[model samples]
Target: MMASRATARATGSFAAYTVSELTSLIRASLESAFGTIWVEGEISNFRLAPSGHTYLTLKDEVSGIRAVVFRGVGKRLGFCLENGLRVVCRGRLTVYEPRGDYQIIIDALEPKGIGARQLALEQLKARLADEGLFDTARKRALPSFPQQIGVVTSIAGAVVWDIIKVVHRRFPLADILIFPVTVQGQLAGRDIARMIRELNTQRTSDVLIVARGGGSAEDLRAFNEEQVARAIYQSRVPVISAVGHEIDYTVADLVADYRASTPSAAAEAATPALTELVNRLQSNHTRLAHSFSRLLQQWWAKVEALNVAGLDPQAVLQRYLQRVDELETRIGVCVMRNIDRVKEHVLGLCQGLGYCGPTKHTVRLVERVSHLTLRQDKQIVSFLETKSRAVESAGARLHALSPLAVLERGYAIARHWPSLKLLRAATDARVHDRVQLQLFNGCLLCKVQEVQQ
Candidate 1:
């Protein structure tokens, strides 16, 4: 027995298994050990591959484990997977043979509670709203005819393509300029702010859109940053916040000039519908033509109703006949009245001549006698002297009362310049005046040089 034991020990070795067999054994062991285990931890090292596979590390204070969800499982999750989010994941355990590392094949994940990113977004939105940045009254109206549209979004996102499509379809003439930016991850908020400032500096766009595709609250945290909110508030051009899904809102949305539910909606808001406008214009044209035609028809009917030539001949003949009758009657009455007046006037004239003939004859004889006497007695000097003395007395009285006589008596008269009234004293002088100086011989017009106090 001792010899047999020695020989067996020399030949004995552990049974070797193939790689696939070993991996399957390990996987079965792990599945049995942690079958459908639920783990609650903070997410870390999250990664999404081009193949639609998500890889991440879930950690707690005690331990952490690597985990992955294939495309089929990942697509079922309602919310985004992000770092530092508290989440509960259910999965089966398995071992990767090539790497010989144990991993959880996650079947499902749900928020353990509200995540930090979500809380941060909510707090920011509340603070901004309290400061009245979100007030509807402060919102600016979007331009109906925007010459250019500015977009602030990720350079590599599908949002830009969606916006371009909608805008091109609605208003092909509208000019669009994209301000490329990071819409997710760290420094995304800063990048968004910088893009907004740069667009403001250029001042080339009439309207600005801050847009991105729909994502979870954590994924859209950049839009809730204070820098992004302030940039939107301070923008001169009207800003449209089109950040996430319809139900998701951020501080950027509250502070923007307008808010659109999606990027496509933002494009629609910024542009006019060409097809609808063309249809409206055609409708108006048809209405205008119809109105004009109706008006022409009414005018033509009015013209046709009137008989211009048919009424003219009868109306003219009636007027002329009536005028001729009135003129004949007036002429006969005027002739009769004139004959009576002429007879009366002639009789009155004869009576007046007869009555004044005696006075006329006496005046004529007296005038003839006076002329003959005056001619015969040319040297009646005493009567002529008396008449001349009376005339001289009257002339002297008139000259003493006259203003010109007063001026001519060696007493100077000063007159107010504009009113032409005589100035009694120096006090009557004003600063602006053309004074008239009345001398004994003549008057002199002079401007006021100065006035004595």
Candidate 2:
């Protein structure tokens, strides 16, 4: 048996593999065996690198495995990755060469308990709410009278027609201007936001109505996007959001100035009923007319009573004249009293002026000026002394910091000749090379005999 084993070895039948080759073989085996698989586990040791790659460990109760999601796949993920999150992943198994360990290269991932889109929506809603975008204080009141109503919706959809019809029925005099946009699919959110901004820039509409027909959550995603919500929040023109049915609400609805149940409701809210306003105005006009007529009739009745009672016109005129004479006498007495009081006030002011004559004032000002001059002279001298001391201190400090002071302490600096480059080490100059030495008084030219290091 020993002879036969030796013969087999001598025939070159033995096989061996390097570390890289073995790892490649193991990777092939793992990929072939597992193919594409779905794994459910809790994430642990989650890390996000600056390069946008995600690294985490997927662990169950019994075991754990390393996983990596490259930038391309990670960018498409709807929700943030975090430790302790329960998730389900789809990928294939492979062997990592440097670590010689098995791992999963993730292609897809989602939270196990909720749908990815829903989770993303909830997270975004919370973030925007924290930024006060959903505050009721930021909401605006719809214009009571919007002459030009701006409608943002899909032109092909029935929503635009519903808004136009409602506006026409309630307030026919108001003009309708439609800003067409896609209400579904990928470009819907961006298109809606862009139209809102453009309408604001134009300033042609008093109020804006952003509406779409009722649809599923997925179909209504355009209204839930952050871009649409921010646009509604920042709109100068008050926005009435009517995205879906009464039971449905979106981010746009929260951020809009007013949330309407439907497209028709939004249009109705934006405009006032012309007939009602006209009726109110007519009622007010009739009431005012009645009040004026009543006033005129009351005056006429007083005159008629006077005539019925046979009041003498000559006697009434004499009585009025006597009253006027008495009023004139009282007004004359009051005028004399006012004139006496004003004369007394003038006398008091004259006495006050005599007490504070200009000569005394000028003397007081001269004394103040002399005092200020003396104080200013003393302050100038003190200031000069302080500045002189500071300058001397600064000069001393500068002299200590000067390189010539170090040279006076017997330290010399060497440099390569001609180039004047500083030589910090012996290796800087080779044997027989020219060098210059800087000293306290002068520089010395020399030749490098040897280099120690």
Candidate 1 regions with alpha-carbon error over 4 angstroms: 1-119, 308-453
Q: At residue 290, give the lDDT of candidate 2.
A: 100
Score candidate 2 by lDDT.
Answer: 0.92
Candidate 2's TM-score reads: 0.65
lDDT of 1: 0.86
Q: Which stretches of candidate 2 lie over 4 Å from their true place?
A: 1-32, 61-63, 82-85, 95-102, 245-247, 286-453
Identify the leading candidate in terms of TM-score. Answer: 2
* Local distance difference test scores for all models: 0.86, 0.92
Candidate 2 residue 159 C-alpha distance from true site, Å? 3.2
